[model samples]
Target: MTTPNNTEHANIAVITGASSGLGEQFYETIAHRYPDLDEIWLIARRKERLEALAERYPNIRARVRALAFDLSAASSYDELSSMLAEEQPVVRVLINNAGFEREGLLRDMAPKDILAMIELNVMGMTMVNRVFLPYMRAGSFEVITGSVSSFAPIPWQTVYSASKAYTRFLARALHEEERKRGVNVLLMSPGNMNTEMNVQGTSTGKLGHLPYLDLKRETARTLMMAERGHATYTPMLFYKLYRLFAKLMPSALAVKVTSIENGDTHGR
Candidate 1:
């Protein structure tokens, strides 16, 4: 937790779930985007992957600290808090991106899977923000990864959609609250991507047929939007339209449409 080179303070960016997917994309892009950062903290459960990532990108100007953390576990937060207390770095950016989804009927999903989704996607994200907010000063940016599914309840991915809804609401509220203090909070709601967590290549559902977003492009755009102080950024024209539709349609109808589109109804 001690500052590198015995420096009294270090300006840093912290990204959770940095082992892969959007989180990894953010880590890859942030160094070039935020050149002032003295260090980048990569947090994930896999220790070897974090280390490999750190070594893979050797030319990054900012020092990389790969700290393996299972955000779903309470002890991870305690250790992170203690490290922050010891280092007291100025947090330049905080990306709360550690989350997963269990795509199945709510009743069929394992109890552990459902609970883990809520714990990481909802509780873990909230705790990460709370733990880091104090260290983020004026001009800092906080990006929370939400999803287009958050706009309405999706039958197959019930818990994930609900959790993202919480994320959207929380980030929007925090945007207003943090803006007064000059900290920008952005809610990034993106559609499906072909990431390790969500592989679209082996899909049979209508949701799978939808165009997959360019992860790199979306990641860069999200950082840009965050810098511009946007409260929310939903990528792709299709998803933007979907968001509008969800807002205009009745709740029950919206849910029904989503379930049908996701191919969860199966003509039922």
Candidate 2:
């Protein structure tokens, strides 16, 4: 609740969606990997969850700041900007990981859900990057959590895929832009993982059968790739091959193939 002293030039890591899943994993990875960090900022909508996560690292060297902000709301960005101005901390790493997906046909999805996807996955992530990037000095790393769905137009997960495509392009472009400034921007396009966001259910259809990556290992690998100056990290050989296939195949055919592969035969 209390801000760190303004006079202290704390080296910090900022992680959005740090309440659970991959975001939580990123916190753990950063804690171990960057022991010199003076603070770790955990941003999410759930205050209690963020606090709980912070409590887990009580014995760690860095101070944990649990910032509960709903990134979908414009006010959250304003608040974060104010706090950053006050703290003026040196951002060692920034992870824009707050996003959600609602699986279904476009028409079947609620209007609010579609907008929410764009709000958080696209707008929220973009704003977080903008607000934090200035505080990140040379050698600081920024990671945008993309998805394998970004490779092509997926039928069932239409909005989620489209949003990730936005993230993919933005992150890659930023990588080039920031590289000149000696900052690294990494796009981590992970496939399905056993996280709360990817809970197994009947609606998952064929996606539930796909191989899931270990959250810890993949998170670690992503950080390693970023540290090595890689612009993007797509885990698992299967998804890697799929990315190639999506690139080589025609757009129309790829959409049709993905539709059928996911058991969506309504149009046919």
Using lDDT, give the best candidate's number: 1
lDDT of 2 by residue, 25-130 (tens): 9999998888899999999989999998998977789999999899999998788888888878988899989988876788878898899999999999888888
Where model 2 places Cα greater than 4 Å from the true spot, the runs are: 1-8, 200-204, 260-268
- Model 1, 107-220: lDDT tens digits are 887898888889999999899988898888888998999989899988887888899899999999999999998999999998877776567676667776777889888889
TM-score per model over all chains: 0.93, 0.92
Q: What is the clash count for each candidate, in the order shown? A: 0, 0
Global lDDT scores for all candidate models: 0.85, 0.84
The segments of candidate 1 whose C-alpha lies over 4 angstroms from its true place after superposition are: 1-8, 260-268
